[model samples]
Target: MHLVVRPLSTVKSSLFYSTSSHVPARAMVYAQYGKPSEVLSRMPLYRIHKHTLPDVKPQDVHIRFLAAPINPADCNQVEGVYPIKPPFNTSLGSDEPVAVGGNEGVAEVIALGDQVKGFSVGDKVVMAQAGRGTWRSHAALPASEVQLLPGFNSQVSLVHAATLTAHPHINVDNVEHHIGDYVIQNGANSAVGQFVIQIAHAWGLKTINVVRDRPNLDELKEYLTSLGATHILTEEELSKRETRSKLKGWLDGRKLRLALNCVGGKNATELGRYLDHEGKHVTYGAMSKQPMAVPAAPLIFKDVSYHGFWVSRWTDTHSRQEREAMFGDLINLIKEGKLREPVWEKVSWKLNASEQENETAFKEAVNKGITGFGKGKQIVFFED
Candidate 1:
């Protein structure tokens, strides 16, 4: 099924429409890097006025956003800590240069240029590369800047498309894989870790998942187990000798070919301990904010290698065709029910509300996400 853009007449406010080629839009803008709550509050809720949507160039496509996720990296970027930064520019109608706050989301094409090809007015698409600000209601982007989700059908939910870019399944696909191979990972309950477990299971790989023990540890374990985790343990259990013995028996002399680490502390070291010769350990996040202590034994004796996988960097270096191919594959997985969207909560954006009201709602959600209050990922869903 395709997503059609709503007609201008149906929009609640004239703030969203234009008589000329330029389209009116709204965005969460930040002029300087600092705390998200503070920096984001410096400007009015709708910093981007009607003039921001410059006339769609020959290579440009106009789009209306469906949803965008507030990822940890997005916060870090707003705080001036992330490695990649969106170029601060006056494209958003600001007198001074500023950047939008989101990196991942799904949008429907509302208009296209004469020079563009292979994309219809209603096709659903995602950013082809990182740093095109996504925390906005509309944008006129170059055709090369967005990638179409060819397999995006009715079964592929909006939540999955919005969070797809930052999902950990890309790491699972990038790492070395073979049927029957054993994979180990920490943060099994994290958004990325959950996808890793499901994808590995679908690919015939055995996964040993480690998580921090919580009050409802048993329930969490059961949920992950149902997702096809071959084994589950806590950080404390991972350090125990008996636990290692049990894992050894389960391995039955088969070695762990890969380890996906998000927590970078003692637990990460333990994951490396199980790696087979020439095994690869991929680190994608450091939730603990601590350095990983790697012993030289595995590097020297077992020939194990360590790597850091950042989705932004991967997208920047890969070709559009290659990136779209991966997107198509994951969308198909969702269609087949082999993959599922992460737990997430939506913050609604009412088009009819006052700008201040909408801004307050958006900031409240970001603050909750930064404080880690919610049980699921927080996403902004635009309402017509």
Candidate 2:
């Protein structure tokens, strides 16, 4: 048998490698945590003076951020309420040591460092972990913390790329329930909840989405139903027995297998009452700033489970390969047009002139509730 000889040039380009380039990177820096207006006003504006792409160490890769969303978690981080804190560095040309702000974004690989493997320049990627700055343009991170998506289609818009990073990993592939599997969510219109609804629908699961009866209820429900939501319920309806009785027909007397709770307090407790036996209630956010209280009866008799999830912590625990796989599936669904990003309000950020004005704009967007919040995710586009 003749041995097959492969060309060396093709092999080298397919693997991880770094090349020198003259691209400048910019970043948004914060000196301290406070209210959005105050803290964001204090953000120091800076651009790389020289092309000093940090020499990629064995496990590092350089990323050029395409887009990053202005998530509530990012606001919480600025307010000093978030659990994970970004490292503050004084050497970055700020008078006060500054930390970068941003949690979720999609990026493109510009270069790879020595000892890095399986990734190269021009690869589309997502942060394997959250809390790394994705606000500006470009970052150097561990290869283990960056997941490459070779099969990701560009048809998935930048807004969807930024927003999808906020969703939790639900094992939709192995989910035992089908399209009629009654799923309940409080923040039905939230970026994360919207994704949950779409993914559940694609997996043949039914959804009971709850939102406050804002002025735009009809429009919001129409948007969600377009994503396959089975029913929409307002907070007022969820509190009534008659409404709950009406839901029984949809579940066909079968209990709900999953409940997604972002707003806590009474809303969470009430949603807990509708779960079928052995169902799981996953709480990812405390939008109401209230603690969830579950009656012991459901816990002891119904054998329900309450789980709290933070995407940051989830990324830290899961391997990079696992994240790539999860994102691969998500991107595919997006490519198929089954998943879409919610309405996005763009906040333009200019270096120094409009920084203060934009900070106020950011705060205003965050203060809007339910349907009142403009639409979709609020994206900050930084321009040089």
Candidate 3:
């Protein structure tokens, strides 16, 4: 791997407009861990930093980032809370050791190493796992760092390919349900929750989705139902004694075999109440930022098993071939129209734009993602 070293003069400028032919790249970088807004910089003023990139080596493939999402995990990672950490280094030409932001996105290969046989210059690929920075204009990475998107050339849109990694991978791993089994999930409107409904539908499993009530409660329920949700209930509805009776009626005696939780606290505990004996509860996120107050009755008497799923860990343990196969399956699902991309607001990065402008755009996107301002996911789309 080639190391990146920035000149002292470049560091003095608040805004970097690279005119050099040797190296040219920019990224949202941070040297210290703190609140993402406070710690992440775009220019010298905030936290965004510009840097030179090493030339593609015999084993490297040069790629330009097409788009990336501001996922909750990405924000958490920036806040120094996520379990997976990007290797902090001077690779971005920072005076101090720093790491780039973002963990998920799709990139287009623009140049290839002589020794890289499998990947061609035009292939679209995604990171093999988390912690590899995707929030940048370009990268020169090992051929093994990314996997080709089989559906990208055909039916998959940049929006779909860019946002594919986290949600689908977790659902496939955490929920092991057969055709007839029923699964329940909280945060049904979230990206992963939506996937759980669609994937479960595609596989012939039933899903009872739970979400908090809003002013447009009926509209939200209708929307989720259209996504193949078997039933949609508010948190209050799920907690009702009568609601359990209604669920029993809905199940018609089939066991509720799996529960997927993104919201912790009372919501998570309530979600587990309806599980059948020997059912499994899989927690993938904690949007509520509260502990799961699971009752002991289900654990002791019903033999309920609790587990957590993190896609980063999943990708690390699985082989390259296995990850590619999973991607292929997801692409096939997209081709068949059984799977759909989540709603998203694009944060476009223009190559000609000033570094300050680009940084401001990303900061807004992150704030929107963190504050829950919009109805869709926030994705950054890079443009020339």
Candidate 4:
């Protein structure tokens, strides 16, 4: 990895946001941890003070962010509740140390470091590091922090690439899912759950999805079914014996190999009854805000395996090469149309624009990311 040392004179003028095209940038920042609505603020970039008579650093690349999505975890980080907290620093224009908001976004290399090897100007890249302050119009980062996609192909849309990091782990290690195995999941319409359906489809795995009954439940069911969800059931339906029997017969006596529990509570417990002997139950989220309650009988008699899934923790134990291989495979699936991204409410964030407009765009996107506005993921994209 190369280190970037900016020139002293250049750093002085760029201290509170460089008006120079060399590193024009702005970011969503927070000085103190608190609620996203209360603490998050739009701030200018502040380059480091260094020697005068400088140009773009040899080991630094200026990124023009194409698009970024606001994930639930990103909001949690801003609230100071996430395990992996972004470091707060005076890198941006501020009296006190501050951290930039956003974890996933795609950017293009408008200007490249003279010593940069693999990446080049106009090459598209995504954030390789978590909490690297992605919700910005422009950024000057070390070449190592970003990754150039295979073949340096710009064919991948920013929307699709921005979503890539959010859900690749459902198909990786932990539970050892196999092709053609029957897998079950709750919160079937969620971003993570949707990816599970598509990835399972790509691998010939069948899914039995569980969701809460909603006013537009049928439409949502149709959408997921189109994404290759084998069966869709409401929480009430999944909890009842009558509906359970119907699915059991549909399985034709094949053991349900895996149960993915994102929504805990009675609904989650009800899923265990259908598992085959020694089957695994993986809990990834508690959308219902309820604790997991597994019947004692399953552990004693049926020999069920109950496990929790945490992507951040998984990355810590796995090698970078392993993670990259999985990501590359998923991207190919998307390219082949074997995986489809959920419809997003695109929020246009213009670069080098007014503070009010930029703030409005980000505020709206962040609000939607929290509220799931229009029942879709919220993405902030640039004009050019």
Model 4 scores what on Cα lDDT?
0.73
lDDT of 2 by residue, 1-384 (tens): 011122234344345466433345556667777776555344343222122345556567777777777777787787778888887776444566777778878787777666667876678787777777777666777877776764766687877777666775653422367545678889988777788888888887788999989898999899889988889999889989997789887788655878888899999988888988888888888888999898898889999989877777667777776777777888888888898777788766543445456555544654542225566567766544
Q: What are the clashing pairs of model 4?
A: 8-50, 8-51, 9-51, 9-52
Of the candidates numbered 2 and 4, which has the greater TM-score value? 2
Per-candidate clashes come to 0, 6, 5, 4
Best by TM-score: 1
Better of 1 and 2 by lDDT: 1
Please list the residue runs of candidate 2 whose C-alpha ends up more than 4 Å from where it truly belongs after superposition. Answer: 1-16, 41-52, 55-58, 91-95, 171-176, 349-373, 382-384
Q: What is the Cα-based TM-score of model 4?
A: 0.85
Model 4 ranges with Cα > 4 A deviation: 1-21, 40-60, 111-117, 151-155
Error of model 1, residue 291, in angstroms: 0.8
Write down the RMSD of all candidates, one decimal each. 5.1, 5.7, 7.2, 6.3
> Candidate 2: worst 10 consecutive residues by lDDT?
1-10
Candidates' lDDT values, in order? Answer: 0.81, 0.71, 0.80, 0.73
Q: Is candidate 3 or candidate 4 better by TM-score?
A: 3
Give residue 84's lDDT in candidate 3 (0 to 100): 83
Q: Please, what is the TM-score per model?
A: 0.91, 0.86, 0.90, 0.85
Q: What is the lDDT of residue 323 in candidate 3?
A: 81
Clashing pairs in 1: none
Return the candidate ranking by TM-score, descending: 1, 3, 2, 4
* Residues 98-174 of candidate 4: C-alpha lDDT, one tens digit per residue: 77778888887765555666665666777776878887777777777776655325455667888776665674574
